[model samples]
Structure formats: C-alpha cells, structure tokens
Target: MSTTTVTSTPNPSVFGQSVTYTATVTGITAGTPPWGDVTFVIAGGPTIGPVTLTQTGVDSGTASVTDSSLAVGSHLVTANFVNSSDPLDNSSGTTIQLVNQAATTTTVTFVPPAPVCGETVTLTAHVAAVPPGSGVPTGTVTFIISADGPTVTGTLDPSGNASVTVPALSVGTHQVAAFYNGDANFAASNSPLTPLAINPASSTTTLTTSPPRRSAVSR
Candidate 1:
C-alpha cells in the first residue's frame, strides 16, 4: 500500500500572503513503487494543480504548490495520490493552515498634559495597525480613568482617531487609559496609563469700604 504526508510552509500565514504546500508519497511495500500525479486542495479555498511527483527513493515521490489567495482563517489542506495501479493502494493526507489578522496598537494622549480642577480636558485615542497591514482601524475606543474614576467612549474617525472632552476632574494625579474594540482587519488592544496632574482651582477675594459715605452723613 501507499501512504501520503502533507505539509505547508509558513504555517502561521498572514492574510494575502503566499504559502507553499508540499505532498510526499511513499510505498509501504519495499519493492512496490508509488508513481503518478498528486492533486492538492484547500477546504473552502482554491484548488491547486495536479503536479507530477519525482521519484527519489525506492517508492517515494514529492510534489508542491504555492498559493496566495486564501482567505484569513484556519483551512484544511488535502493531498491525494490517485494514480496508484491498485485502487486500494491510493492514499491521501491532510494538514491545517492558520491565517491571523493584522496586529494593532493603541495610544492615548491629553491635550493639556496638566489641568486645573473644574476645567474641561480633552482626551484623544489613536489606533494604528502594525506594518505590513493595510487600512486604518475602525470602531470605537473606550477611555477610562484608573481607580474607577470615570469612563468615556468615542467612535474612531477615518484617520483612526477618537477624541472626547471629559468633565471636570478632582484635584490629584490620575492615570488615563484607552481601549480599542478592534475591527475586521485589526485586533483589539489597550493603551498604557497616561499620568495627568490636576491642580486645585484658584480662589478670589473682594474688599469694600463705606468710609466716604459715613463722613458725608456726619457733616
């Protein structure tokens, strides 16, 4: 009988990237030889050519195909040896390929770095995909203050930025963070806490005098 083994290069492939699948066929009987063409197919994907294999050993042959149009996700690849002289000797094998979404990063910034109590502060969240990826990040970003202070949400714009003005914050140091909910092409990410200082609001005093009015009345 004959046995087939299948393998893929770049096991963890990225979307729209090229990948190569190889199939090897070997005969179980020492004197028997496995020859002919091998057909490769990807489950829910494109079907490769039925390439002829070259015999290297007693009954061993190998074939390969390269494809780049597979969609992003897990796919089952199969290789079939259908040219064996005996129908029972024909063998097939299967392997798996994983396609991952693009990586992303999130960042948060404060317009004024430092603010005063009872003053409005602007918070901006920037979401960006790592290199080798296409398109900007979409969806919303949730901004929250450490120590469970407050939470604000903003939708990302075309430029992958979201901004919101927060109400007055208490006087002290605060750690602000942003979370990206992610989209179809990018993964979710969280930004590091950004420290912001809020100083106490200043106070004003007033003074009044009635000496001139009192002197005129007495005269």
Candidate 2:
C-alpha cells in the first residue's frame, strides 16, 4: 500500500493569483520506486488532469500542477495517486485552500482637462486590481464634484472604466473624486482628490446704428 499527501503553496492566496499544488507519494518497497500518475480534484474549482509522477527518491514520488483561476472562497483540494503495479494500492489525500478578494485602486479623470464654464464635460473612473493581482474589476463607480456639488454613478465596462457626462460647471476650482463599489472578487477603493478649474466664458460686445446718417444727407 502507498500513502499520498497533498499540499499547496500560498494556501491563503488572493483572487487571480497563481497557486501550485503538489502531491507526494511514499510507502514504497525497498529498491522499487513508485510509478504511475496523480490527479488533482478541487471542489468548486477546475480539475487538473493526470500528471505523471516522477521518482524523487528510492521510495517516494512527486507530482505538481499550477492554477491561477480559483474562485474567492475556501476549496477542498484532493490528490489521487494511482499505482501502475498491482503490488501497490492507490491512495488519496486532502488539503484546504483559501482565496481572498483582491485589492483595487481607483482613479478619476475628466475630458477637456482644462475647460471653460458652460462647456459640458465627461468624467471617467478607472478601477484596477493591485499588483500581484490580475483581471478587470467590475461594479459601479460614484463620482462627486466638490462639497455639496453634483453627484453621479456609472457602471464599469469590460476594461474597468466608468464614465458619466455632466452639464457645464461654474467657473471656479472644484475637487473631484471617484469611489468604486467593489464586486465579489475585488475590494472597494476611493480615488484621491483631483483639482479642476473652469475658466469664465468669453464675452462679446455689439454696436447699434443710429439715424444720424439720414439727417446729415438732408442738410
């Protein structure tokens, strides 16, 4: 009979982060290294196929696989080892893996960076996962303009960008920021205050014509 043990690196991993699962087989007779394959079965996760085991020692063998698409939750990871020779019996082992939500950063920007009063502008928010984490963040981003100013919310697109159009702003300086409402796989975040200035609209003057021309011609 053979004994199998399973283990995972970075047991507590962030969503979208890569994790490696390894299976070690032992309890082999003297001078006869174990030979066969090992397969990984994960609950609520993808199943990894039969990876041929390699003899790491005189009486032990090892197999490993790496995966990066696990969901954000606890998973029951199992390793099943199959022995090619009839003399040995197949064995299995189990382990636990925890995946947490990834952190995110939010940034806000507006079109017509330098704008004049009475000119419409479009505000955009971008949300991205922190380093070591990958994949676009989903959900809504709420935009606020100055204290007690106008507020709007926009949904995230495939590229993690949300945009909303606002009417002309008053001529002055205003603080703008974006707040990202996180999804199941990512954490919420707020952007730093972005200062914006709106210049005063230009003015135009018109002249009026009088009847003096007609009086001069008569004289």
Candidate 3:
C-alpha cells in the first residue's frame, strides 16, 4: 500500500494569483521507488491533470503543477495517485485552499477645478485592483461630502468609474471622499479625504453717468 500527501504554496492566495500544488507518494519498500501519475481534483471546481510523478528517493516520488484560475472561495483539493509500474495500492490525499478577493484602490475627483456656491458639481470615483492582482473592479461607489452633505451612490462603468452630481454646495471648504463597494473579485476601498472650496458667487455693480458729457459738448 502507498500513502499520498498534498500541499500548496501560498495557501491563502488572492484571486487571479498563481498557486502551485504538489503531491508526494510514499510507503514503498526500501530501495524501491513508487512510479506513476497523480491527478488533482477540486470539489465543485475543475480537474487539473494526470501529472507524472518524479522519483525523489528510494521509497517516494512527487508531482507538481501550477494553477491560477481559482475563484474567491474555500476549495477542497484532492490528489489521487495512479500506480502504473509498481505493485503498490493507489492512494489519495486532501487539503483545503483559500482564495481571497484582490485588493483595490479608490480615488475621488471633481470636475471644474474651481466651483461657485449654488452651482452643480460632478464628483467622480475610480477603482482599480492593486498590483500583483489585475482586472477592472466593478460595483457601486458612494460619494460623501462634509457633514450635512447629501450621500449619493453611483454604479461603476466598464472602466471602473462612477460619477454623481451634487447641486448647491454652500460656500466654504468641504471635505469629499468616495468609498467603493467592491465586487466578488475585488476588495472594498476608500479614497483619501479631498478638500473642495466653493467660493461665493461674483457680485454685480451698476453705475450711471450724468451731466458731465452735456457740459463738455456745449463748450
């Protein structure tokens, strides 16, 4: 009979990140190494391959494969050994692999660098997956202004951008920020606080010219 054990590197990996799994078969008699292939299977997931085992010692052999297509969830991984050139019985091993959402960054900006009181302004938020993890982040983003300001939500587009229009901001310095409600493939994130200044509306003046022009014409 033979015993098989399986393990993974970077057990808890991020979505779309590469992971390697290895299986080792042992329990053979001294001076006799096990020979055959090992197949990997994931519960509720896809099957890897029938990778050939490499002889490592007198009684043990190993096989390994790298994969990067697992979704964000906990997976039950199993390795089954198939005996081809040995008299040992087939064996299997099981292990758990965890996948987490990719990290994200959120940024908030406003159109029209300068704004005036009582004018409508558009606030935009952009979300992106952190390095080592790729793909555009989806879902909604919430926009917030200073205390007492309205809270608005906007759905993201294909480019990971969301926008909301805010009308009638009082004249003063207001802090604005955006929070991204992450999707299944990316983690939530918040943008740094940004200060927006809304200056008071421009004042208007009226002037009148009187008899000075008439006196000069008479002269």
Candidate 4:
C-alpha cells in the first residue's frame, strides 16, 4: 500500500512574505515491494520564493519552507517523493502533492467613471470607489451603446471613465447615451425642448412693425 497525501498550500499572509513549510504524510507503504527509502522535495513559486523547499529526507518525509520569505502573489506548490531512498525502484512523478494560493491583488479604485448624458465622460478602472462605505461596483464589465449612443471604448481613465462625445443633437427627447458595462444598465439622456425658440413675430405686429414706409400721401 503506497502512501498518498495532500498538503494545503501556505498563505503568503501579507504581500512579499515567505515562510518555511512542512507537510504531514498521511498513508505510507512502510515496508513493501522494492523498499529502500524515499526522498522529499519542494517545487513551485519563485527562485527566491516558493521555488522549492530546502529540506530533504527519507520516504514519507516533511519538506521545510519559509513562506513569509516570498513576495506577495499567487503560488503553486508541490511535494514530490523521489526514489533516492529506494535504489531498486528508480522513478519520478510517482508520489506528488499539489496546492494553489493567491495573495490577492489590492488597489481599489473606481472603474469606468460614472457615465453621463450628452457629455464626454472618462472612466477609470478599479475594485473600490467612494471608499469604505461609498461607491463600490460589482463584477467585471464592458461598455456599449443603445439609442443615439455616444462613442464608448474599453479605454478607461484613472477613475475608469470611458470617454464618449456627443455632438449637437436634434430637438426632441432621446436616449442620447447607453452604458454597456457588460451589464444592461440603461443610462438615459433625454433632450429637453430647446429652452427659447425664436417666437415668430405676430403677423399682426410684423406689418405695423416694418420700417415706416414713406407715406405715398406725403410724397
């Protein structure tokens, strides 16, 4: 009965911290077919990070590693049992353990600055905005158009505001803009009636208002 085991990957705790590691073997063959000894080794991470543990020993051995000594980021670790201990059985990849972890990217900023109607808007990308208890959006997203939509692109600003420019539009209501954050969030722009229209001079007043005609009677 060969030994099989699974070790949980160590967390980096804070970014850029590595620590020593040791795995607890579960099942072992003890003494069976072609028995001599077993060697353990570490692998993954980076050269100065998880790359591999420095501890080496017989079969069913625990690897030594310092995870805090590694940089903050994602890492994949594996423990392998080499045939060094057993001379009769020469092989690799027979016994191995694997695990994965993420340090978590932290840099919360607002993404795609809030979209506006009929105005050029610039958007930035981020995981947080408004801070603590304020503006915070959810999930991955993209922008688009619906009706009389403005120009939108993937390019985002520091605040993740996509730029959209809308030129002068005709009079009448309109959904001048559409926000396609990958989500169908209908941001609307309604053109209010042009505030002041040239009220045509009343015909009754126009004729009388015209330059006083030299009276033919006076001529």
Residue 41 Cα positional deviation in candidate 1, in Å, after optimal superposition? 11
**Candidate 4 lDDT:** 0.32
How many pairs of residues collide in each model? 0, 0, 0, 37
- In model 2, the worst 10-residue window by lDDT is 210-219
TM-score winner, 1 or 3: 3
Q: State the TM-score for model 1.
A: 0.58
Minimum summed lDDT over a 10-residue window in model 3 is located at 210-219
TM-score of 2: 0.92
TM-score of each: 0.58, 0.92, 0.80, 0.31
Candidate 2, residue 199: how far the Cα is off, in Å = 1.2
Which scores greater on TM-score, model 1 or model 4? 1
Using lDDT as the measure, the top candidate is 2
lDDT of 3 by residue, 4-71 (tens): 99998888988778888999999557777888899999875679889998999989999998887788
> On residues 1-219, what C-alpha lDDT tens digit does candidate 2 reach at each position?
888999999889998999999999985577677888899999988899799998899889899999989889999999999898853579999999999999999999989999898998899999999966778999999999995459999999999999999888888998999999999999999999999888999999999997765545654
**Alpha-carbon RMSD, each predicted model:** 6.2, 2.3, 4.0, 12.2
The lDDT, on a scale of 0 to 1, for candidate 2 is 0.90
Candidate 4: stretches off by over 4 Å: 1-6, 9-22, 25-44, 47-76, 79-141, 156-219
Which candidate, 2 or 3, would have the higher TM-score against the true structure?
2
lDDT for model 3 comes to 0.89
